[model samples]
Target chain A: MPLVNRVKELRARHHLTQGDLAAKVGVTRQTIISLEKGSYTPSLMLAMQIARVFEEPVEFIFTIEEETE
Target chain B: MKRVIIQSLSSIILYILMAFTIASFASTVTHSLAALKSGVFVLEFNFLPFLLLIIFFVVWTIYSFRTRPNQQMGFGQWSVRMTEFSEVDEREALITAKATKAAYVSFSISVPLFMLTFFFYPLFQTAWPTYPVFALVSTLIIANLVYMTTWIRAYTR
Candidate 1:
Protein backbone atom coordinates (compact mmCIF):
# COMPACT_ATOMS: atom_id res chain seq x y z
CA MET A 1 0.00 0.00 0.00
CA PRO A 2 1.13 3.55 -0.72
CA LEU A 3 -0.72 4.93 2.28
CA VAL A 4 -0.07 4.59 6.02
CA ASN A 5 -2.76 4.57 8.70
CA ARG A 6 -2.93 4.76 12.50
CA VAL A 7 -5.40 1.82 12.64
CA LYS A 8 -3.37 -0.45 14.91
CA GLU A 9 -2.18 2.38 17.12
CA LEU A 10 -5.67 3.81 17.45
CA ARG A 11 -7.10 0.35 18.07
CA ALA A 12 -4.52 -0.21 20.83
CA ARG A 13 -5.37 3.15 22.33
CA HIS A 14 -9.03 2.15 22.58
CA HIS A 15 -8.21 -1.43 23.73
CA LEU A 16 -10.29 -2.79 20.85
CA THR A 17 -9.83 -6.16 19.22
CA GLN A 18 -9.84 -6.46 15.44
CA GLY A 19 -13.22 -8.17 15.72
CA ASP A 20 -14.62 -5.17 17.57
CA LEU A 21 -13.21 -2.80 14.93
CA ALA A 22 -14.56 -4.95 12.14
CA ALA A 23 -17.99 -4.98 13.81
CA LYS A 24 -17.91 -1.19 14.09
CA VAL A 25 -17.04 -0.95 10.36
CA GLY A 26 -19.59 -3.60 9.28
CA VAL A 27 -16.86 -5.86 7.88
CA THR A 28 -15.51 -9.29 8.74
CA ARG A 29 -12.62 -9.58 11.26
CA GLN A 30 -10.43 -10.91 8.46
CA THR A 31 -10.87 -7.55 6.72
CA ILE A 32 -9.56 -5.77 9.78
CA ILE A 33 -6.57 -8.15 9.95
CA SER A 34 -5.89 -7.60 6.26
CA LEU A 35 -6.02 -3.81 6.72
CA GLU A 36 -3.58 -3.93 9.63
CA LYS A 37 -1.25 -6.27 7.74
CA GLY A 38 -1.33 -4.06 4.59
CA SER A 39 -2.44 -7.06 2.61
CA TYR A 40 -5.73 -5.49 1.50
CA THR A 41 -7.07 -1.98 1.06
CA PRO A 42 -10.39 -0.83 2.46
CA SER A 43 -13.15 0.77 0.39
CA LEU A 44 -14.03 4.45 0.77
CA MET A 45 -16.97 3.69 3.03
CA LEU A 46 -14.82 1.38 5.15
CA ALA A 47 -12.16 4.06 5.39
CA MET A 48 -14.76 6.52 6.59
CA GLN A 49 -16.04 3.99 9.08
CA ILE A 50 -12.55 3.35 10.43
CA ALA A 51 -12.02 7.11 10.84
CA ARG A 52 -15.31 7.33 12.73
CA VAL A 53 -14.30 4.49 15.05
CA PHE A 54 -11.04 6.24 15.94
CA GLU A 55 -12.84 9.57 16.34
CA GLU A 56 -10.45 11.27 13.90
CA PRO A 57 -10.57 12.90 10.45
CA VAL A 58 -9.64 10.61 7.51
CA GLU A 59 -6.54 12.71 6.81
CA PHE A 60 -5.52 12.50 10.45
CA ILE A 61 -5.77 8.67 10.44
CA PHE A 62 -4.33 7.96 7.00
CA THR A 63 -1.85 9.70 4.70
CA ILE A 64 0.10 8.93 1.55
CA GLU A 65 3.59 7.73 2.38
CA GLU A 66 5.75 9.15 -0.41
CA GLU A 67 8.93 7.27 -1.28
CA THR A 68 12.24 9.06 -0.99
CA GLU A 69 13.89 9.91 -4.32
CA MET B 1 -24.67 -17.08 19.86
CA LYS B 2 -27.78 -18.86 18.77
CA ARG B 3 -26.67 -19.02 15.12
CA VAL B 4 -23.21 -20.37 15.98
CA ILE B 5 -24.68 -22.91 18.34
CA ILE B 6 -27.10 -24.07 15.67
CA GLN B 7 -24.37 -24.46 13.03
CA SER B 8 -22.10 -26.44 15.35
CA LEU B 9 -25.00 -28.63 16.46
CA SER B 10 -25.90 -29.43 12.87
CA SER B 11 -22.30 -30.20 11.84
CA ILE B 12 -21.68 -32.41 14.84
CA ILE B 13 -24.97 -34.23 14.28
CA LEU B 14 -24.08 -34.82 10.66
CA TYR B 15 -20.67 -36.23 11.59
CA ILE B 16 -22.16 -38.52 14.22
CA LEU B 17 -24.84 -39.74 11.86
CA MET B 18 -22.17 -40.53 9.25
CA ALA B 19 -20.14 -42.53 11.78
CA PHE B 20 -23.18 -44.53 12.89
CA THR B 21 -24.02 -45.36 9.30
CA ILE B 22 -20.45 -46.63 8.74
CA ALA B 23 -20.56 -48.78 11.88
CA SER B 24 -23.92 -50.29 10.93
CA PHE B 25 -22.65 -51.02 7.43
CA ALA B 26 -19.59 -52.73 8.94
CA SER B 27 -21.70 -54.94 11.23
CA THR B 28 -24.03 -55.93 8.40
CA VAL B 29 -21.09 -56.80 6.15
CA THR B 30 -19.58 -58.96 8.94
CA HIS B 31 -22.86 -60.85 9.40
CA SER B 32 -23.35 -61.33 5.65
CA LEU B 33 -19.79 -62.47 4.78
CA ALA B 34 -20.94 -65.71 3.13
CA ALA B 35 -23.57 -63.99 0.98
CA LEU B 36 -21.26 -61.10 -0.03
CA LYS B 37 -18.67 -63.22 -1.95
CA SER B 38 -21.08 -65.72 -3.52
CA GLY B 39 -23.26 -63.23 -5.46
CA VAL B 40 -23.92 -59.61 -6.33
CA PHE B 41 -23.48 -57.51 -3.14
CA VAL B 42 -26.80 -57.60 -1.30
CA LEU B 43 -27.09 -57.29 2.48
CA GLU B 44 -29.06 -60.03 4.35
CA PHE B 45 -31.67 -57.31 5.01
CA ASN B 46 -32.05 -58.78 8.56
CA PHE B 47 -33.78 -57.01 11.47
CA LEU B 48 -30.73 -57.24 13.79
CA PRO B 49 -28.41 -55.40 11.40
CA PHE B 50 -31.03 -52.79 10.57
CA LEU B 51 -31.86 -52.17 14.23
CA LEU B 52 -28.23 -51.99 15.21
CA LEU B 53 -27.55 -49.46 12.46
CA ILE B 54 -30.53 -47.32 13.44
CA ILE B 55 -29.57 -47.40 17.11
CA PHE B 56 -25.98 -46.43 16.38
CA PHE B 57 -27.12 -43.48 14.22
CA VAL B 58 -29.62 -42.29 16.82
CA VAL B 59 -27.07 -42.52 19.62
CA TRP B 60 -24.59 -40.29 17.78
CA THR B 61 -27.30 -37.80 16.81
CA ILE B 62 -28.44 -37.48 20.44
CA TYR B 63 -24.84 -37.14 21.61
CA SER B 64 -24.23 -34.31 19.11
CA PHE B 65 -27.38 -32.54 20.30
CA ARG B 66 -25.95 -32.53 23.81
CA THR B 67 -22.31 -31.56 23.03
CA ARG B 68 -22.38 -28.82 20.37
CA PRO B 69 -20.34 -25.60 20.79
CA ASN B 70 -22.03 -22.60 22.38
CA GLN B 71 -19.26 -20.05 21.83
CA GLN B 72 -19.21 -17.34 19.14
CA MET B 73 -16.74 -17.69 16.22
CA GLY B 74 -14.33 -14.95 15.17
CA PHE B 75 -14.61 -13.06 11.83
CA GLY B 76 -12.12 -15.40 10.11
CA GLN B 77 -14.73 -18.14 10.53
CA TRP B 78 -16.47 -17.12 7.29
CA SER B 79 -13.62 -15.69 5.21
CA VAL B 80 -10.97 -17.72 3.38
CA ARG B 81 -7.50 -17.41 4.97
CA MET B 82 -5.44 -17.79 1.79
CA THR B 83 -5.17 -14.68 -0.39
CA GLU B 84 -3.49 -16.44 -3.34
CA PHE B 85 -6.58 -18.40 -4.30
CA SER B 86 -9.32 -17.10 -6.69
CA GLU B 87 -7.92 -14.28 -8.76
CA VAL B 88 -10.09 -11.14 -9.20
CA ASP B 89 -8.80 -9.40 -12.34
CA GLU B 90 -8.35 -9.52 -16.17
CA ARG B 91 -5.51 -12.07 -15.86
CA GLU B 92 -8.00 -14.53 -14.44
CA ALA B 93 -10.11 -14.14 -17.59
CA LEU B 94 -7.11 -15.02 -19.75
CA ILE B 95 -6.28 -18.09 -17.65
CA THR B 96 -9.90 -19.19 -17.93
CA ALA B 97 -9.71 -19.00 -21.74
CA LYS B 98 -6.55 -21.16 -21.77
CA ALA B 99 -8.22 -23.80 -19.58
CA THR B 100 -11.26 -23.81 -21.87
CA LYS B 101 -9.01 -24.47 -24.86
CA ALA B 102 -7.46 -27.39 -22.98
CA ALA B 103 -10.92 -28.80 -22.14
CA TYR B 104 -11.96 -28.60 -25.82
CA VAL B 105 -8.83 -30.49 -26.87
CA SER B 106 -9.45 -33.13 -24.18
CA PHE B 107 -13.07 -33.56 -25.28
CA SER B 108 -12.17 -33.84 -28.96
CA ILE B 109 -9.58 -36.46 -28.09
CA SER B 110 -12.17 -38.38 -26.02
CA VAL B 111 -14.90 -38.54 -28.73
CA PRO B 112 -13.16 -41.35 -30.64
CA LEU B 113 -12.89 -43.39 -27.39
CA PHE B 114 -16.69 -43.19 -26.84
CA MET B 115 -17.34 -44.02 -30.49
CA LEU B 116 -14.93 -46.99 -30.19
CA THR B 117 -16.88 -48.29 -27.18
CA PHE B 118 -20.15 -48.15 -29.20
CA PHE B 119 -18.42 -49.77 -32.20
CA PHE B 120 -17.09 -52.66 -30.02
CA TYR B 121 -20.15 -53.32 -27.73
CA PRO B 122 -22.11 -54.83 -30.65
CA LEU B 123 -19.42 -57.49 -31.35
CA PHE B 124 -19.80 -58.85 -27.76
CA GLN B 125 -23.62 -59.22 -27.87
CA THR B 126 -25.94 -60.69 -30.48
CA ALA B 127 -29.03 -59.02 -28.85
CA TRP B 128 -29.90 -55.33 -28.47
CA PRO B 129 -27.95 -53.56 -25.72
CA THR B 130 -29.45 -52.06 -22.53
CA TYR B 131 -30.50 -48.39 -22.05
CA PRO B 132 -27.49 -47.80 -19.77
CA VAL B 133 -25.05 -48.12 -22.71
CA PHE B 134 -26.96 -45.60 -24.82
CA ALA B 135 -27.41 -43.30 -21.79
CA LEU B 136 -23.68 -43.45 -21.04
CA VAL B 137 -22.78 -42.70 -24.68
CA SER B 138 -25.08 -39.68 -24.95
CA THR B 139 -24.01 -38.28 -21.57
CA LEU B 140 -20.36 -38.45 -22.60
CA ILE B 141 -21.15 -36.44 -25.73
CA ILE B 142 -23.27 -33.88 -23.85
CA ALA B 143 -20.74 -33.44 -21.04
CA ASN B 144 -17.87 -32.90 -23.45
CA LEU B 145 -19.78 -30.31 -25.52
CA VAL B 146 -21.04 -28.46 -22.44
CA TYR B 147 -17.58 -28.42 -20.86
CA MET B 148 -16.00 -27.16 -24.06
CA THR B 149 -18.58 -24.41 -24.60
CA THR B 150 -18.57 -23.12 -21.02
CA TRP B 151 -14.79 -23.20 -20.74
CA ILE B 152 -14.47 -21.36 -24.11
CA ARG B 153 -17.06 -18.75 -23.09
CA ALA B 154 -15.28 -17.89 -19.81
CA TYR B 155 -12.43 -16.35 -21.82
CA THR B 156 -14.53 -14.00 -23.95
CA ARG B 157 -15.26 -10.39 -22.93
Candidate 2:
Protein backbone atom coordinates (compact mmCIF):
# COMPACT_ATOMS: atom_id res chain seq x y z
CA MET A 1 0.00 0.00 0.00
CA PRO A 2 1.26 3.42 -0.92
CA LEU A 3 1.35 6.06 1.76
CA VAL A 4 -1.01 8.93 1.00
CA ASN A 5 -0.56 12.30 2.64
CA ARG A 6 -2.61 15.51 3.01
CA VAL A 7 0.51 17.65 3.35
CA LYS A 8 -0.37 19.94 0.49
CA GLU A 9 -4.01 20.41 1.52
CA LEU A 10 -3.14 20.84 5.17
CA ARG A 11 -0.33 23.26 4.37
CA ALA A 12 -2.74 25.37 2.37
CA ARG A 13 -5.42 25.21 5.09
CA HIS A 14 -2.82 26.38 7.56
CA HIS A 15 -1.92 29.28 5.22
CA LEU A 16 1.68 28.11 4.86
CA THR A 17 3.85 28.05 1.77
CA GLN A 18 6.02 25.08 0.99
CA GLY A 19 9.08 26.96 2.16
CA ASP A 20 7.29 28.04 5.32
CA LEU A 21 6.28 24.48 6.17
CA ALA A 22 9.74 23.21 5.39
CA ALA A 23 11.25 25.84 7.65
CA LYS A 24 8.95 24.81 10.48
CA VAL A 25 9.89 21.15 10.03
CA GLY A 26 13.62 21.78 9.43
CA VAL A 27 13.68 20.30 5.96
CA THR A 28 14.43 21.68 2.51
CA ARG A 29 11.67 23.07 0.31
CA GLN A 30 12.47 20.31 -2.17
CA THR A 31 11.51 17.71 0.41
CA ILE A 32 8.16 19.45 0.92
CA ILE A 33 7.64 19.57 -2.82
CA SER A 34 8.41 15.87 -3.12
CA LEU A 35 6.05 15.11 -0.29
CA GLU A 36 3.18 17.00 -1.88
CA LYS A 37 3.84 15.38 -5.24
CA GLY A 38 3.48 11.97 -3.59
CA SER A 39 6.92 11.01 -4.79
CA TYR A 40 8.39 10.76 -1.29
CA THR A 41 7.12 9.31 1.97
CA PRO A 42 8.20 11.24 4.98
CA SER A 43 9.96 9.49 7.84
CA LEU A 44 8.08 9.05 11.12
CA MET A 45 9.85 11.99 12.68
CA LEU A 46 9.15 14.20 9.70
CA ALA A 47 5.52 13.10 9.54
CA MET A 48 5.09 13.93 13.20
CA GLN A 49 6.77 17.28 12.71
CA ILE A 50 4.42 18.10 9.84
CA ALA A 51 1.42 17.04 11.90
CA ARG A 52 2.58 19.19 14.78
CA VAL A 53 3.03 22.21 12.51
CA PHE A 54 -0.44 21.73 11.08
CA GLU A 55 -1.89 20.94 14.55
CA GLU A 56 -3.30 17.66 13.24
CA PRO A 57 -2.85 14.03 14.20
CA VAL A 58 -0.24 12.07 12.29
CA GLU A 59 -2.92 9.59 11.22
CA PHE A 60 -4.98 12.44 9.80
CA ILE A 61 -2.11 13.78 7.73
CA PHE A 62 -0.87 10.37 6.49
CA THR A 63 -2.64 7.09 5.73
CA ILE A 64 -1.94 3.89 3.83
CA GLU A 65 -4.04 3.61 0.70
CA GLU A 66 -5.62 0.23 -0.07
CA GLU A 67 -3.97 -1.47 -3.02
CA THR A 68 -6.32 -1.75 -5.97
CA GLU A 69 -4.11 -3.65 -8.37
CA MET B 1 22.09 23.66 -6.80
CA LYS B 2 24.22 25.80 -9.05
CA ARG B 3 26.98 25.72 -6.49
CA VAL B 4 26.85 21.93 -6.33
CA ILE B 5 27.08 21.60 -10.07
CA ILE B 6 29.99 23.97 -10.19
CA GLN B 7 31.70 22.07 -7.42
CA SER B 8 31.41 18.79 -9.35
CA LEU B 9 32.79 20.32 -12.53
CA SER B 10 35.63 21.94 -10.65
CA SER B 11 36.52 18.62 -9.04
CA ILE B 12 36.66 16.91 -12.42
CA ILE B 13 39.01 19.58 -13.68
CA LEU B 14 41.10 19.26 -10.55
CA TYR B 15 41.51 15.50 -11.04
CA ILE B 16 42.61 15.96 -14.64
CA LEU B 17 45.09 18.64 -13.62
CA MET B 18 46.49 16.40 -10.91
CA ALA B 19 47.05 13.60 -13.43
CA PHE B 20 48.91 15.92 -15.77
CA THR B 21 51.04 17.27 -12.93
CA ILE B 22 51.99 13.81 -11.70
CA ALA B 23 52.70 12.49 -15.18
CA SER B 24 54.90 15.44 -16.08
CA PHE B 25 56.80 15.35 -12.79
CA ALA B 26 57.41 11.62 -13.08
CA SER B 27 58.54 11.87 -16.69
CA THR B 28 60.90 14.73 -15.92
CA VAL B 29 62.60 12.91 -13.09
CA THR B 30 62.86 9.64 -15.02
CA HIS B 31 64.38 11.30 -18.09
CA SER B 32 66.77 13.35 -15.99
CA LEU B 33 67.97 10.24 -14.19
CA ALA B 34 68.40 8.32 -17.46
CA ALA B 35 70.33 11.23 -19.02
CA LEU B 36 72.66 11.50 -16.01
CA LYS B 37 73.34 7.74 -16.02
CA SER B 38 74.32 7.94 -19.72
CA GLY B 39 76.78 10.81 -18.98
CA VAL B 40 74.49 13.33 -20.82
CA PHE B 41 73.98 15.37 -17.60
CA VAL B 42 70.87 17.15 -18.94
CA LEU B 43 68.41 18.68 -16.46
CA GLU B 44 65.43 19.42 -18.71
CA PHE B 45 62.39 20.18 -16.62
CA ASN B 46 59.20 22.19 -17.03
CA PHE B 47 57.67 23.90 -13.95
CA LEU B 48 54.50 25.17 -15.62
CA PRO B 49 52.33 22.13 -14.87
CA PHE B 50 53.51 21.92 -11.29
CA LEU B 51 52.87 25.61 -10.70
CA LEU B 52 49.42 25.46 -12.31
CA LEU B 53 48.55 22.40 -10.25
CA ILE B 54 49.40 24.24 -7.03
CA ILE B 55 47.38 27.32 -7.98
CA PHE B 56 44.35 25.28 -8.97
CA PHE B 57 44.55 23.13 -5.84
CA VAL B 58 44.49 26.22 -3.64
CA VAL B 59 41.54 27.71 -5.50
CA TRP B 60 39.54 24.48 -5.49
CA THR B 61 40.21 23.89 -1.81
CA ILE B 62 38.97 27.36 -0.92
CA TYR B 63 35.87 27.06 -3.08
CA SER B 64 35.03 23.59 -1.79
CA PHE B 65 35.35 24.55 1.86
CA ARG B 66 33.26 27.68 1.38
CA THR B 67 30.41 25.97 -0.49
CA ARG B 68 30.28 22.53 1.18
CA PRO B 69 28.30 21.71 4.32
CA ASN B 70 30.16 22.47 7.52
CA GLN B 71 30.46 19.67 10.06
CA GLN B 72 30.45 21.00 13.60
CA MET B 73 33.82 20.32 15.20
CA GLY B 74 32.36 20.70 18.71
CA PHE B 75 32.06 23.78 20.91
CA GLY B 76 31.54 26.21 18.02
CA GLN B 77 34.51 24.97 16.05
CA TRP B 78 34.20 23.94 12.41
CA SER B 79 36.49 22.52 9.74
CA VAL B 80 36.66 21.54 6.08
CA ARG B 81 33.80 19.37 4.86
CA MET B 82 33.87 16.43 2.46
CA THR B 83 31.33 16.50 -0.31
CA GLU B 84 28.63 13.80 -0.30
CA PHE B 85 29.74 12.83 3.20
CA SER B 86 28.21 15.57 5.29
CA GLU B 87 24.69 16.73 4.52
CA VAL B 88 22.19 19.13 6.07
CA ASP B 89 19.09 16.94 5.90
CA GLU B 90 17.84 13.41 5.54
CA ARG B 91 17.03 13.69 1.85
CA GLU B 92 20.44 15.14 1.10
CA ALA B 93 22.00 12.41 3.17
CA LEU B 94 20.11 9.74 1.26
CA ILE B 95 21.16 11.27 -2.03
CA THR B 96 24.78 11.33 -0.91
CA ALA B 97 24.61 7.69 0.10
CA LYS B 98 23.25 6.78 -3.32
CA ALA B 99 25.95 8.83 -4.99
CA THR B 100 28.59 7.16 -2.88
CA LYS B 101 27.34 3.75 -3.95
CA ALA B 102 27.46 4.89 -7.56
CA ALA B 103 31.06 5.98 -7.08
CA TYR B 104 31.97 2.66 -5.56
CA VAL B 105 30.36 0.75 -8.40
CA SER B 106 32.19 2.84 -10.95
CA PHE B 107 35.45 2.32 -9.15
CA SER B 108 34.93 -1.43 -9.10
CA ILE B 109 34.12 -1.49 -12.80
CA SER B 110 36.87 0.91 -13.73
CA VAL B 111 39.80 -0.68 -11.95
CA PRO B 112 39.58 -3.94 -13.89
CA LEU B 113 39.15 -2.07 -17.15
CA PHE B 114 42.21 0.00 -16.39
CA MET B 115 44.13 -3.08 -15.44
CA LEU B 116 43.18 -4.72 -18.72
CA THR B 117 44.69 -1.76 -20.48
CA PHE B 118 47.95 -2.63 -18.78
CA PHE B 119 48.42 -5.59 -21.14
CA PHE B 120 48.89 -3.13 -23.97
CA TYR B 121 51.36 -1.08 -21.94
CA PRO B 122 54.39 -2.91 -23.27
CA LEU B 123 53.53 -2.08 -26.85
CA PHE B 124 53.32 1.65 -26.09
CA GLN B 125 56.05 1.76 -23.46
CA THR B 126 58.55 3.65 -25.64
CA ALA B 127 56.09 5.78 -27.58
CA TRP B 128 53.82 6.61 -24.63
CA PRO B 129 55.62 6.32 -21.36
CA THR B 130 52.81 8.09 -19.52
CA TYR B 131 50.07 5.69 -20.62
CA PRO B 132 49.83 3.94 -17.25
CA VAL B 133 49.75 7.24 -15.41
CA PHE B 134 46.84 8.39 -17.55
CA ALA B 135 45.06 5.07 -17.16
CA LEU B 136 45.32 5.30 -13.39
CA VAL B 137 44.09 8.88 -13.34
CA SER B 138 41.24 8.04 -15.70
CA THR B 139 39.90 5.50 -13.19
CA LEU B 140 39.60 8.12 -10.48
CA ILE B 141 38.09 10.60 -12.92
CA ILE B 142 35.43 8.15 -14.09
CA ALA B 143 34.41 7.32 -10.51
CA ASN B 144 34.01 10.97 -9.63
CA LEU B 145 32.02 11.64 -12.79
CA VAL B 146 29.69 8.76 -12.07
CA TYR B 147 29.12 9.98 -8.52
CA MET B 148 28.39 13.50 -9.72
CA THR B 149 26.04 12.29 -12.43
CA THR B 150 24.15 10.08 -9.98
CA TRP B 151 23.90 12.88 -7.43
CA ILE B 152 22.66 15.40 -9.98
CA ARG B 153 20.13 12.97 -11.39
CA ALA B 154 18.79 12.13 -7.95
CA TYR B 155 18.40 15.81 -7.13
CA THR B 156 16.67 16.65 -10.38
CA ARG B 157 14.45 13.59 -10.44
Best by lDDT: 2
> What RMSD does each model have against the real structure?
13.5, 2.6
**Candidate that scores best on TM-score:** 2
Candidate 1 is graded, for docking, as incorrect
Cand. 1 TM to true fold: 0.34
> Which candidate leads the pack in DockQ?
2
| Model 1 misplaced regions, further than 4 Å | A67-69, B1-157
On the 0 to 100 scale, the lDDT of residue B45 in model 2 is: 68
DockQ of each: 0.06, 0.62
Chain B TM-score (each prediction, in order): 0.29, 0.87
After superposition, the stretches of candidate 2 with alpha carbons farther than 4 Å from their true spots are A67-69, B71-80, B84-86
Interface RMSD in angstroms for candidate 1: 10.0
Question: Would you give me the overall lDDT of model 1?
Answer: 0.55
Q: List the residue pairs that clash in candidate 2.
A: none
| Alpha-carbon deviation at B25 in model 1, angstroms | 25
